[model samples]
Target: MTAPQTAEQPVYDPSDPSVMANPFPIYAKLREDDPVHWSPSLKSWIITRYTDVRDLLLSDHLSVNRLATFYQSLPPADAVLLKDIVHYLNLWLAFRDPPDHTRVRRILRHAFTASAIEHMRPNITEITDLLLDRLESGGRNEVDLIREFALQLPAFVIMDLLDVPRDMLDDFKEWSDDMAVFIGGARNSGDKYERAERGCRKMSSYFAQLIKERTENPKPGFLMDLISARDEGDKLSEDELIATCILVLFAGHETTTNLIGNATLLLLRHPDQLAKLKSDPALIDSAIEEVLRFDGPTNALVRVAAEDHDLHGRQIREGERVFVMVNSANRDPRIFKDPDRFDITRQQNRHLTFGQGIHLCLGAKLAREEGRIAVERLFARFQNLALDPSEPPEWLDAMVPRGTRHLPVLLNG
Candidate 1:
């Protein structure tokens, strides 16, 4: 009888294409051999297992307040600039812990109800339709879907949601892009960090101005809602309101943009699944779910251990950062049978794409709806949607919400 051979362990490198393009093999090995291994490269513990990841996310012992510690670790001069950046991040709902997270979430939920998202479907559909039409008007047989369609759809939707003036659309996108690059920890050179700080300062000032104007004129939007919303007779502070706006504006569209682009490219690569989707357009929802599980927009989230603890036979100390590999947990063989293969019709597909626990994405439902509409409308409009032979897909170096930089596709009738 031949003995079973073990898979070689891979060094952790979040930006490596080998890891980004296909992290399952590495994740599988880690899950089996070292589920709670610490990575010196990341300076954090990497948790990669369906059960462990889910449990840690739900555990109150860990915290999302690790950013402050990170900022403090920077050089003195950089810390000054990072202080201004972290100021806004500190107020973000995603970066808060305990009582603050509980309070802000309660207030924020009032604005993002399912009914509100459903009501916006008509507007979302209108935006998607218009963007698709714009794609064709350029008089080109090939188009970069990432730039021409996927990117604009979510930005416009967010603009509409926030009642942002149409004139400010370009500025908003620039700011959001900067935020994503900075937050995703991609291309983190000194110049890049400076650019992120400039973006943070500009957005902070812009939102502050908007809040001041809205205070007197009043408006119908998420910003306005946050302005007026009260929790136990406590309304959001001016700084809090500005921070929340920045958080939602960036989080709202960035993930969806990646989701649409990633899902479309996935479908283009897997013709069998694409044929299935085209054959039964109703499967768009399930197909979107599958793409999310297969190659989710987000790869991991960092949480800090609150105290010393033992997990899966490994000891973790207080204040140490833990990187929960959501992308890995979704593909755990224990949970999903034949997890490597893409099957849109897979039943009971419980993936951690939107994450779980109290911090689950508030925009999950809306993002899913947008992905569904984008896929359905694109396939319906173009009979032939294949990757452009001239330009291959360029995956972004981002680790958090990984996706293509541009996806040029041959769009033929």
Candidate 2:
């Protein structure tokens, strides 16, 4: 079967409400009928199959640094307006390739090692308990889990990791939310460019100050580590340092927030799985992995073709954008047996939630630890946790990140 070239065929639009709510069915159709699809509207080839997505992620034929091309393609006036945003975004480690990426990854690896993440287990537990304390004391059974719990937990965790004060979380969230609108490809957001530019400027300025303070009076955490991180005398430039801090603050919490939110909601919907997990808390690790594979936070990963090449019969021209649908790939039956089933005990899971290869998520371990701690604590605290029947959970309408906008649930303790 193949996607027919007919006017009646529905085009893949990430911003579409129905698709954002539950894209799996559409993903299944595209995977079976058109594994490599070209979206006329998006002007990007969407890769859905697991093998193709993984290979592309690990392939040297693609480039993660597409901001320059984007800026060049923009109108002069628009480009001028977005120069600051592009400058900082260009400096992000995630957007760099080759030697630069290699150097930075080496220096940064020390901070995110398995032992380092495990050491923070106690701190993670403390943060989780603190947040749960607040949630339980709210004097109401109904609450928006995304805002009250899921969002705040990772924000606090990252904030603590950076030695940022708790009072600054609201400001950080505001700036991160604005930037997410632009970076997440929120199609309907008006003035997204301006908002993102403002956010970029404010966040950059804040990080610059923090970096200056940390330089003069170094703290004992990840931020301090990044400040002194040097690989063969190759240290991060001032701009690179600031950009990395912003990246950590933004990317660190946002995806984990989605992970916790998605996992909790999924469990609530699947009482049998929830019961199983509750009965055997040892499955928390496997359950977290399953959540990552089942309905992970990341929706798509974008890359640009480094050179013209044919992929699965489709000619990918240089500079063209490619949307590697990780969500689609995770559900690919070829890689996962009965991929649609929400089985927490599945052992052969090899989902690309954190991506693959050298560009794999730097904070994957932290995110996993955070998710495990958060979900375990939440379920343990509220035995009768469930979705509020009156209000259905709303998913975020963005192309890059998948998460709940609001998860109203009954914490029937």
Candidate 3:
């Protein structure tokens, strides 16, 4: 991990929606202008250099538990959301760092293996087909790519993985949407809290019943497997299990939903690449990698300094917050061939979309499957697909991730 120096002033202010709206340019400027800077808003230094972000990610001196730092960075009101919701429950692995992260992660690790996801391939294929059936049934109408394909696939796949019945699919989606409010676009303060609170209560109750039932009469499923697995003698606590389930279901749905939507929009934006993919099909994997490289769903992650140390020369005080911009690193010219353009055939492509180190996204395999299959099916179904060129995409730039809220596309059979 290459360390970098910085001044007391912030490199950039990400809280501004305008900056968040199109941060690539700003990120590019930051990497060139001031790779390391302190933000008055965040009160934390920003690290934008591709090498620096990579170094900090793998460095033992930094911990992913940036809860305290994140709270301070937020406006007083926004602090409530971070402290109350994102921090309190400690549901997911992304929030944890080091030994515990390794411990808790080991239990659920087996379930996310390639073979485990392989068992789900047939089901994912079926769900993808069923969704497209609904869209095509409508025929020639203005289709919202986000709702129809992006949101629908992940919701069902995650529900099915957790052995959520075929019946409560709608309920699952509603719960996911509510939970996503804090992170996704158009988050209403009242509505976000209301929805998240309601979701937390409902999901906790529902999973409690499931956990109890599995305890009494265990089945052969993800929920059952997770419950059964124990390290030495210690097992994941009830809250941990519930929180873990919530993380898997919610995180699984959230990022992949945006991946499909963003990929679709970007592909049409580059018609030649789409045509190349449509013609060759072999390029889809590389294309998928590039889509994430170009504009992955997740913007950045929060980390805290675990020790007072020097990064590239500047002193990083212990407990200070750091926002590691993964998206910015993906576009760094030092790592990538052409940092900006969307080139499907670009060979030496390795983007940090799933993040890095011990905290790399767990469900990346499943997400990639959904993205690959969704694009394949979509291009196959619609011969000539293009943006409703006139109508602009409704962009959703929220606190959590980035993607269009609604992308209306004209699909021709």
Candidate 4:
């Protein structure tokens, strides 16, 4: 990597919330100064270029193992839980690497196959239409897209996939939100902590009941599929079953919701691209890809160096934690043209929103499906949709997640 003549600031903290809000400029400078500048803040080198990021992912030295995360820190179980929570923020696939990753991922393989997604098309469309009905009834009065549509929308689809009762969807949403807080260390010490604890307990109990019921009498949902799936006396243990179910429920709803919200906000911001898409609905597929590229819900992945290794000529001892700024890598000018612009028709976009390598997201197909349908149904319902003139979508500022809390918008009825 060529080191450009960029001045390195004396202090740049990756952990700082303000920096997390927009880390690109700092990333640009870091990539110039060898895309692997060790941050005093994190005490780890940040990899900012696309090639280096991909290279390190495939490198034998960098380990995405749970033990790797707590190499210098927590107890094994606690470390495992922490790493699980870290990936759980993106619903936990982010924690596994190689063998262990390959093992658990198998249980979910058939769950999200292309054919599986096709089987799901009916329910997905139903959910979209149901939401569109509510929006149409909402009348000319401005509606908060996040609250009225995007936020609640994914929860329904996820509930359907999990065969979870509709009444519990609201609770699941709260739990996932609380989990996000815990992951970022942004939770309030009291109410937030209590909420997260309760959420965990409730989720376990809920899935436990479903597991029991599914065992007694199988059904046609994914939960039932898991209950029936057997491989050489290898079935998901009780805890593993609960954990995996929680993982799916939280993942299926939250991240896709954020993706839809992000894409909608981007479209509103870039009227030309929005107009182009509306003029040609066929662009919806690529538009979702562009949205995943322009600003993914996840900004980085926490990786631990598995063994002592050299990164950019600097010795990184085993167990050292490194945060791969995948978000920054996706925007490298070397890989993307005007990388920051919102171009709906952008071809050759291979973004890291779903991540890469062995730990890549399983729900990615489901997410893109949800995104395309939501936007398609949304556009179909609202003809002259524009930003709610008075209030554009304001981003929810948090360290781990990037999305809008409420997207207020107007529609020509």
lDDT of each: 0.83, 0.89, 0.78, 0.72
lDDT by residue for model 3 (296-348), tens: 88777667889988865667788887777888888999989778999888887
**Highest lDDT among the candidates is held by which one?**
2
Model 2 lDDT on a 0 to 1 scale: 0.89
Instruction: Name the candidate, 3 or 4, with the larger TM-score value.
Output: 3
Cα lDDT for residue 355, model 1?
A: 80
User: Which pairs clash in the backbone of model 1?
Assistant: none
**Taking the tens digit of each residue's C-alpha lDDT, what string does model 2 give over 62-103?**
999988899899998889889988998888778889887888
Point out the worst 10-residue segment of candidate 4 by lDDT.
1-10
Note the clash tally of each candidate: 0, 0, 7, 3
Off by over 4 Å in 3: 1-18, 68-88, 166-170, 181-195, 312-314
Looking at model 4, residue 359 earns an lDDT score of 70
lDDT of 4 by residue, 285-380 (tens): 999998888888766666777887776676777777666777788888999999978898888998877777787778888889989999888877
Worst 10 residues of 3 by lDDT: 1-10
Least well predicted 10-residue stretch by lDDT in candidate 1? 1-10
